[model samples]
Target: MLLEATDIHKTFQEGRETVHVLNGVTLSLARGEIVSLEGPSGSGKTTLLSIVGCILTPTSGRVVIEQHGVNAQHQGELARVRRQYIGFVFQQFNLFPALTALENIEYALNIKGVKGAAAQREAQRVLVAVGLAERLHFLPRDLSGGQKQRVAVARALAGNSPLILADEPTANLDSVTGGQVLEMFRALAKQENRGLLIVTHDPKVRAVADRVLKIEDGRLI
Candidate 1:
C-alpha cells in the first residue's frame, strides 16, 4: 500500500457548537491504481481527501505512507514528506492569472528549490505529456475549460509526485471534454505507475476508476 489511514477521526468547533465531520474513517491505496470516492453533497468525502493529502491533520488516527516509512515522523516532517510525494488537483482550475501555463508548472518546481534551465525543460516535458505543449505560452484567461484543466494537470505532474489527489477534477467540463480529462488521468495512472485517488460525484469518472467507494453521513458504506 502507498497510503494507509487507520481509524481516522476529525471534528470542528464553530463558536460553541462542535460539528462532526469524519468518524472513524479508514482508507488505503496501492501503486498504479485509480480509486474514486463517491458521495453526495454534505458527505465527508472531501474531508477524507483533505486528510489523506496532509492538508488537514486528523484529530486522532494514524496516517502512514508506506514507501517513505513516515508513521513515526512529527507534524512538520510529515508535511515535508507529503510535499515531496503528493500532488493535488482541485475542481477549480487554480492557475495563476499572471503566469503562463509553462511558468505555472515551473513555479511548482521552484517551490521544491529545483531551479535553472533544467526545471523549465522538465516542466515543458510534463506539459507535453498532458497534451498542452502547443499552448505553453497561454495564460489561464485565454485558455478554454479543457485546456485549462490540462494545464492544472501539468502543474500537478511537474513534481513527479507518486500520489495524486484530485477533488472533483472534471466538475466544470462538458461531458465530452470531461471524458477526455478522465482518459488523461487513466493514462497518467498507467504510464506513470502512480496512485491516483479522485473525490468526485461525477458518474463518468466513477466508470474509469479501478475501485469506487461510496460515502454517506460521514461513513464509508
Candidate 2:
C-alpha cells in the first residue's frame, strides 16, 4: 500500500463547543489506483485528506505512508514525510500569480531540494507530461481555468511523490474540462504507478475511480 489511514478521528474546540470532524475513518490506497472520496460540504473530506497527506494530525488512530508511521508529534518529521511521500492539489489552482507554469513547477521542485538546471529539466518533464509544454511560459492569469488546474497537477507531480491528495480539484472547471482532468489523473495513476486519493463531489470523478468512498457526518457509510 502506498497510503494507509486507519481509524482516524479529529475534533476541534470552538469556545465552549466541541466539534467532531472525523470518526474512525479508515482507508487504504495502493500504487496504480485512484480512489474518489465523495461527500457533501463539511463532511470531513478535506479534514481526512489533510490527515492522510500528513498536513494535519488526527485526534487518534494512525496514518502510514509507504509503511512508515506518521509522527505527528514532531512538526519537522511531518514536513519531511509530506515532502518525501505526498503531493497536494487544491480546489483553487494554487499557483503563484507571479510565476509562469514552468517556474511554478520549478518552485515546487526547489522545495524538494532540487535546484538550478536539474529543477528546470524535471519541471519541464512534468509539464510536458501534462501536455503543457507549449504553455510553460504562460502565467496563471493568462491561462484558462483548465490550464491553470493542469499546471497545479504538474506541480503536484514535480517531486514524483508516491501519493497524491487532491481536494475538489475540478470544482472550478466545466464538465468537459473536468473530464479531461479526470482522464489525466487516471493515466497518471496507471502509467506512473502512483496512488491518488481525490476528494470531490463531482459524480464525473467517481466514473474514473477504481473505488468510490462516500463520507457522511464524519463517518464513511
Candidate 3:
C-alpha cells in the first residue's frame, strides 16, 4: 500500500464546544489506483486530506505512508516525510504568477534539492507527460483554467512521489477539460505506478475513480 490511514479522527476546538470532524475514518490506497472521496462542503474532506498528508495532527489514529508511521509530535520529521512521499494538487491551481509553467514545476524540484540542468530536465519531462510541452513558457495568467490545472498536476508529479493527494482537482474546469484531466490521472496511475487519493464533489470526477468513498457527518458512509 502506498498510503494507509487507520481509524483517523480530528476534532477542532470552538469557542466553548468541540467540533468533531473526522470520526474513525480508515482508508488504504494502493499503487496504480485512483480513489475519490466525495463529500459535501464543510464535511471534513479537506481536513482528512490534511491529516493524511501529515500537515495536521489527527486527534486520534495513525497515518502510515509506505509503511512509515507519521509522528505528529515531530513537526520537522513529519514535514520531511510528507515531502518525501506525497505530492498535492489543489482546487485553486496555486501557481506562482511570476513564473512560467516550466519554471513553476522547476521551482518545486529546486526546493526538493534538485538544481540546475537536472531540475530543468525533470520539469520539462513532467510537463510533457501532462501534454503541456508547448505551454512551457506561458505564465499562469496566459493559460486557460484547464491548462493551469494541468500545470498543477505536473508540479505534483514532478517530485516523483509515490502518492498524490488532490483536493477538488477538477473543481475549476469545464466538463470536457475536467474529463481530460481525469483521464490523464488514470494514465499516470497505471504508467507511473502512482497512487492517487482525490477529494471532490463532482460526479464526473467520481465516475472516473476506481473506488468512490462517501463521507457524511464526519464518518465514511
Candidate 4:
C-alpha cells in the first residue's frame, strides 16, 4: 500500500466542549489508484489530509506508510520522510510570485540538494511534461489559473514522490480546465504508478477517482 491509516482519531478541546475532527477513520490506497475523499465543508477532509501527510499528530490510533507505523518516528525524522515520500498540490497555485515557471520547479529540486545545471535540466523536462515548455520564463501573474495549476503539478511531479496529497485541486478552475487537470492526474497515476488522494466535493471529479469515499461528521459514511 502507498498510504494507510488505522483507526485514526483526533480531537480538540475548546473550553467546556471538545471538537472531534476524525473519528476512527481508516483507509488504504494502493499504487496507481486515485481515491477521492468526498465530503462537505466541516466534514474533516482537510483534517484527514493533514494527518495523513504528518502535518498534524493524531490524538489516537496510527497512520502507516508503506506498512511502517508513524508513532515510532521522531518529529524531525518523520518530517524528512514525509518530504521525501509525499507531494502536495493545493487549491491555490501557491507559487512564488517573483519566480518564473522554471525557477519555481527548480526550487523544489534545490531543497532536495539538486542544483546548478542538473537542476535546470530536470525542471525543464518537468515543465515540458506538464505542457508549459513555452511558458517557462513567465511569472505567476503572467500565467492563467490553468497554467498556474499545471506549474503546481510540475512542481509536485519534480519530486517524484510515491504519494500525492491534494486538497481541492479543482476548486480554482473552470469545469473544462478542471477536467484537463484531472486527466493529467489520471495519466500520472497510470503511467508513473503512484498513489493520488484528492479531497474534493465536486461530483465531476468523483468519476475520475478509482474509488469514492464519503466522510460526514468526522466518520466514514
List, residue by residue over 109-167, the lDDT tens digit for candidate 4. Answer: 88866799988998998789889999999999999999999999888777677888888
Clashes of 4: 0
Clashing pairs in 1: none
Q: What is the C-alpha local distance difference test score of each model?
A: 0.85, 0.92, 0.91, 0.87
Per candidate, the number of residue pairs that clash is 0, 0, 0, 0
lDDT of 1 by residue, 33-152 (tens): 899999999888998998888877788887777555554337777668766888888799898999999998898888766788988998899899989879999989999999888888
Number of the top-ranking candidate, with TM-score as the measure = 2
Worst 10 residues of 1 by lDDT: 65-74
Model 3 C-alpha lDDT per residue in residues 1-221, reported as the tens digit of each score = 88999999999999999999999999999988899999988888899999999899999999999989889889998879777888889899999999999999999888777889999999999999999999999999999999999999999898788989999998899999999998997788678989999999899877778999998878899
Clashes of 3: 0
Minimal lDDT window, size 10, model 3: 77-86
Error of 2 at 18 (Å): 0.9
Q: Which of the two, 1 or 2, has more TM-score?
A: 2
Q: What lDDT score goes with residue 64 in model 1?
A: 73
In model 4, what are the clashing residue pairs, if there are any?
none
RMSD score of candidate 3 (Å): 0.9
Worst ten in a row by lDDT for model 2:
184-193
